[model samples]
Target: MGEQQNPFRTGGIARGHRFADREREVARIGQGLREAGGKLLVYGPRRMGKTSAIARALDLEQARGGTVARADLSTLSSLADMADVVLREVTRAVAAGKGFDDFLAEILKRVNIGFSVKQDASTGVPIPQVDVSMRSKPLEEQKLAVGEVFDAIDGMAAEHGIVIGLVLDEFQEIHRFEENFSEWNLRHIIEQHENVGYVLAGSKRSLIDRMLEADGAFYRMFDKLTVGPIAEDYLVPWMEERLAPLGDGAGEASERIVALAGERTHDRMRLARHTWFRAQQAGRSGRGAVDHAFAGLVEEDADEFLRQWVHLTVPQQNVLRAVSMKVKGLSTADTLQRFALKNSPTAVQAAQVLVERELLFQRPGEKGYFFDNPYFEAWVRERTAIDLGMEPPE
Candidate 1:
């Protein structure tokens, strides 16, 4: 067979082999799950390794002969999709081969009496999907059906002699029910359950606590764990060690990777993957190779970057340019005036929109917002002549 692909990966869950520098966090999560139905509310900005950490912990749990089910709630578009998927994952993890519609019908027997099972018209096999008769039902009743799905899953998992670890990535999607409907309802049902070790991961702090007010649903519902940037001291040595198999300057190459990508784990891995291949082409490794690789990244991502930019309003584009330029007091009158934005409100609104879209990421407990994708941010700065201040080696 051809040699294996690059060890560094980006844009998806990092499993046991590739995930780095999160041993302590992984151990904490594993211990929580190993306890009797332990719960965790893991919070971090996007790409900061929250999902990876949960996946790693769950992998360890599975290794120890535990049942672990996971679903990315963000992919579900409707309240019905959420109910179907959660039931699907939990059932698949506990009892394999049962389709989502069958498992869902079994669970909803009590809460949703107005749904039917239908076979696939698109195929020869019996691929079934549930059809709820409550098409015009009140949103509250619809939300409650999803909550009951969780309750039923908990009951089944408890019967199996151990707690099932259910990791819900992007748990904030629960708020799609409007106001606090989904979060409040789910929180109530989840809290009363005893057979599910639930770990919820989300990037947006505001949405994570959408129901966190004193009168809120999930106010103190979780034992919160904040995932942050993997410290450079821990990361650089690991990078140097991993990069060594590639050849000569892998020992000296980690710093350049960190310099370009800073402390975000996935971004560093991606840029390093590109840098390693670039160094392979040049037959050496150093800061110089890092530069060529980065320039190549700017080129590779040009079309995508333009696609992102053209969708922005002029004010949003101006706010992004200000961020790219590293202008001081980003929402202040001085900065907005300097960046060509008309007023503080416009600049503030633009910044919030960018943040919400995750084109920009405001670090947890940090001062400024930066591009979620580091390479994209680098392109912005270089395109605008914002001087990243890195120097290629001689």
Candidate 2:
């Protein structure tokens, strides 16, 4: 076949027509940002497209003449880092509508924080760079700086008459900075800023839930939205449509692809992309194409998967096998015996560790846990034996 653009993509924040059917989620986020004093918490497991939906919503909000600022809080190391992200993104968004020189003067006049601003060569929008040396400052001073940044954003929104909204992606990571203190401080600051809307998004479901419990600081502080797997009814037809122009037998190919890809959005797109490539090479499309693609992907990750498998304890490995095979009642007698676990408690304990490592996950009301990565589960199925092998000698 000739060189043709693959109609599929994975990873990163998908937008425009490249995004999946997340109309409801996008609309909810947009509405939250448009509302006065709106605080929304959007969360779900990794690779479910929450970030993409939020990105699309932010674009729509900005297009409607709303000012939007987004910062990913996942990788920050200190309170000072969080402050810098908020300051940088807010100033960048503000500068998009005004002269960089004038904006800097206005911000310096209003807020006490120091910043160096420069205009981007391509977009000409001003970018604010914060001092990284603040990492060495006292923790209290850093925390105060974060509050000052939020106060400045609120003041800026009021003065400009712009509907300003902010998104802090992976907001749960804030807890790492100061335990529950960060949550309380954030809630207090957010409550005082009635002019600015906030969206706190994260992929760590368990931690997020704990933060929203009644005793937690964020309880009743924001509206909740959960992004789940795309419905098969929508995904199947959508995949088929995208594949139709590329080759014949798209219908059969799409069904097999989605079924094999399981429920994750990125996984489906990746599998679809690989299957399409295989089909194009062979001049055909079918379940065989999907199988070939799946096998190749599994093989490609064999070394990394083996590295992961070797580190697991014998009980952890057994628990993984049980979950991979969809064994119900993980702590049941039959399950313990079949998986070679010492007892119910041992099985439960090992599974909990796996859950914390993000190798496995459970839905809100589901009784049994599941493999977060379907490909890993497939690897376990194809390569490993069900019987728990004896632990290696010490």
Candidate 3:
């Protein structure tokens, strides 16, 4: 058999059973779009596949003949920057099929971004070059420039009679824009356009919620969805499918590795892959099955993961350790106060930071919080010197 497949996949969408579990989510979003031109806000903790799920949904939409445009808001520094990226993607989507050249020319003219056609040396097809001169405008004027771009996109969608779906990934970063530029643009475009649907995807749940809640400008403006971890039931089957070519014990070994990785399914899959690769290496040394030796290999593979995490601040590390050791409930103020100074705010601050970073979540209807990734939590517990027997430091 070939190299064993890893069950833990951290980045990107997993195909087959890994992706199959998200069908309901995809269908729900798709149904919302069909029912009414709607805006979608997708939120989840880090490594939960929020971006991958949206990408998969967009792929499905495009396959079904709907036009899709994607913009990564993580790199965008201002409202204008995001608008430029979104506009560029919208134009490209418009120019994807036949008459694309004319379509590009029209949208460019509408947005005041000059479009020129240049012949490609290889394909001899005329490529559209958009002169995006709006980048240099003053911050105040930049909003108007962005408005024009959105208007142009709406115009193009109407003229072409095609459904335009725009996806903004890591959208929480848009808050960095001056004057809350990101939120302003989202509110403006989404409110004005009927044909253009948007999917705002981010891993920061709290921030995204604030943006969509009734108190904010985006209140009731978007349909909200939370992308959670892959279902536990699908893990073993997915691993077995990926590791099938590696022979008889591959499935069982993958399961064991997944068990080791714990609730961080993505990490589990990744560790499984590393274990499989190491097992193959061991096979060359006449080692047949992935046994205790393969387990050692998994630890070696996870060394970097361990190293990166260990570098966190003491309080951060302590908080993680606490969560791991006490997974049944949330971390309490009392627990934190034990490690922190009397009446000191450091404990509360630390807990907030962990939640903001998506490392822990507040337990619903409870006082404590829960770690999002059990494996990472366990690793922290095993590595930290903090005694599980003692009360939190005060």
TM-score of each: 0.82, 0.93, 0.78
- 95, model 1: CA deviation in Å? 3.8
**Using lDDT as the measure, what is the rank order of every candidate, best first?**
2, 1, 3
Regions more than 4 Å wrong, model 2 = 97-101, 179-181, 386-394
Across 219-266, the per-residue lDDT of candidate 2 in tens digits comes to 988899999999989888888887776667888888988877778898
> How high is the lDDT of residue 264 in model 1?
71
Worst 10 residues of 3 by lDDT: 284-293
What is every candidate's alpha-carbon RMSD to the true fold? 4.9, 3.6, 5.0
lDDT of 2 at 26: 94
Note the Cα lDDT for every prediction shown: 0.71, 0.81, 0.63
Candidate order (TM-score): 2, 1, 3
For lDDT, candidate 1 versus 2, the one ahead is 2
